[model samples]
Target: MRRAVATVLASTLLFAAAGCGGDDSGSATDGGPDKFKVGAIPIVDVAPLHLGIAKGFFSEQGMEIEVVNTTGGAAAVPGVVSGDFTFAFGNVTSLIVAKSQNLPLKAVAEGNSSTGQDGKDFGGVVVPKDSPITSAKDLAGKQVAVNNLKNIGDTTVRASVRKAGGDPAGVKFVEMPFPDMPAAIANHRVDAAWIVEPFFTTAKNQGAKVIASNFVDAAPDLTVAVYFTSEKVLKEKADLVKRFTAAIEKSLQYATDHPDEARAVLSKYTKIDAGVAEKMTLPAWPQKVNTASVQTIADQMQADGLIKDKFDVAQVLP
Candidate 1:
């Protein structure tokens, strides 16, 4: 059985939230029953959550967490807003867009923040090893595959291309899932693919080289991934939020301190090779959500016309 340690404050938060009639609750403040449900995606960036579960961090916090795997951020947000899950992980852009649309969601904690080290910004445009395209400039009039059009992969690629003195709109963007990116490249169906996670590693293993990483051209502190909860959940279950955040922080500390152990845990959940998990660059663990970092993403989304209105970062953060 996994063992977890909880902070006194977090325990209090859980009780307070539960007492307010949040959901079905049989748990006590001191490790009695399962209480909250957390939804997540399979992306490697959510390593800390997997690590926390493996290490029993949430269990120690007196919370029973239900982990649900969804397609991506687009699907996760609605579940969070509808109270299907108490919390969910999503891209910062998605959160900002939701906020602009007056969704009841707010970010309670930072899930992951990118840095250039170890390919932390592991997303970029890549072509087959033998492709004639040599640079971002060469992508002109070429077809590029993005996991989702106008999403993180595509938006970052567009920014990078523009920074490289290439036309951002020169290349046509094709939508494809990360898992299918390699086949697309191999068939010459697309000149290059913008990808993240297991696909990035897989593509590299298959002789696809990156032309540029988003970190090279985009804002380094841009909010990439985060933990968000609905406003109703926040107002009624502040304690649960605190408990979750505390457990997550502990899990992150453990990951940073015991990388080998963390990688082992990640491999089981992500099915990523142990060696690949070890090689993948992960974002820094934040103690709480950073408002400024989130605002940067919101600003970018507005500029990209992904959101109709600018949202105040503070209002969106718990």
Candidate 2:
């Protein structure tokens, strides 16, 4: 088993030097000093990455990964831009915002996407069991909690509210981590929360009720997140980049083929109980980049005033 170097407070941890372990050593192809520092949140979307580490798919490619655990995608941005992390995971909305601000980054691989069908849930808005704010329109002049401000959660919720005959302009959004959302709703700290699994599963168990599926009406099958790296890494480490993505694709396939095993790995990395991990709605892993789906988000963000301009999706692809 490959043990990753772990760190807290978004601090950096060095797992292994590029060619420090294992015996190929003749360059990465000989199988790896192809070491990577990655920033990620401990959400179920990242199960495939953990699976890759556990199965040694990266090791097979002569690469090693040191995962930097973060609380949200916004927190991971600076680290990736400053080269503290060679790669990181983030929502597509956040990435688009970053690109609009001229951040030199590229998305090397896809992460989790919404399953996009009736009665299927990837993300939703939750309210207290007895709250009078029973529908999206009730959210007007109300505070809604989201993990990151001006990203997927905020954009999707606003779109959803408008579709539900509510005034999206009147709703106020606040930033709150997923773990704290259930309690926030219980205590009336916030009126509602935009959340995803396994916290969605956890919140429902805590007496919170889902008001609406966040994406189904606004934009179904949305590409929620991706694995990205700095522009410098894209230009300077071409071979290593290719190898890294190949490993990611393989890991995604592994997770799809062995969901139970993937959930087991998720429990090891996240605080989720085995039962919650088993019951949570897993994210769809798309290996190929969907420019059109990503464009849909960029267009939405621009309309929502979350970003200044629509960006070229091709510029972010690796």
Candidate 3:
């Protein structure tokens, strides 16, 4: 697995290094890094990062963070490969797919994880109150809106359907932003939505029925997403990567220890209603990156034909 992933990394790094063109912005600092950019979406998974910033965790490492809000991992990848971001938050599926395509990425820290409970996980598939899709099995032949197509959203949603004895490949997936999904479901533009917290809670509040906690169905305590950087940055800025990893681990631990603080920090970075943020199911932020769950996602990606390579999750780990 390591060889397979490393082989792809080697191919991408050669291409990425050629594109660098001597830009030291990724690692030009003589002293401990002062400020670096991290591309992330304003989702509940990233609340730990916001809380850490507010709590001075990164600053404690003699570093500062400038979080660049992205639509999703799809956007985060290019931003990092192009040197627009030193690091980015993305799912195991995205990073693994990026690896198969030789995108030169590496995971540095655990981003967020599933609650590992049915009906209680932070992400799920939801249908409007009057919809007939009462269970994951009912999703067969249905149109589902996901924040991104061919990524974590659909793969996990497929897992949920498969677990419920339904044909996973029969579901039709459509791409729509998380923020736009609730309205789309209510209007019947999509039969259901694979969404996460804020929207998950928001959809439920709007009388949507939760048919499945897809992340939980995919894997127990699944490591849904992670913080990552390009291989070029990993090699050139080893110090930055080390410090950032330490800080992120500390931030994740702190968030796990303080749920109230994590929930409160969401208001600072997202437009989620305070009430919804307060009551939303929070994902686990393990101090240690969960590589096992990541492997599960990698297998899902291959099973779903999202990756054509024998990618190893370990090659991307810090």
Can you give the lDDT of residue 184 in candidate 2? 89
Ranking by lDDT: 3, 2, 1
Could you tell me every candidate's TM-score relative to the true structure? Answer: 0.84, 0.88, 0.91
Clashing pairs in 1: 13-239, 14-239
* Model 3 Cα lDDT, one tens digit per residue, 1-318: 353354455544644664752342344367765677889998899998988988998888878788989878866776677677778998887778777776778888889889888988888999988998888999889999988777899999999999999998889999899999888877888999999988889888888899998998998789888899888777877888888898998999999999999999998888889899878999988877777888888888888878876668888876
Q: Deviation in angstroms for 279 in model 1?
A: 3.0
| Runs off by more than 4 Å, candidate 1 | 1-31, 117-120
Q: What is the lDDT of candidate 3?
A: 0.83
Candidate number with greatest lDDT: 3
How does residue 241 of candidate 2 score in lDDT?
79
Per-residue C-alpha lDDT of model 2 across residues 1-318, encoded as one tens digit per residue: 011111121222211332121222113453324765788988888889989988999888878788889877777766676566778899887777767666777898988777786447756899988888777878889999999777788888987898889989998999888888878887878889998888888888888888888776567687788998877677777787788899998998888889888879977777887788878888777677667778877888888877666667777755
lDDT of each: 0.69, 0.77, 0.83
Q: Highest TM-score, which number? A: 3
C-alpha displacement of 29 in model 1, angstroms? 12
Candidate 1 local lDDT, 48-129, one digit each (tens): 8888887789988877777888656666766675556778888776666666656667887777766644244656678988
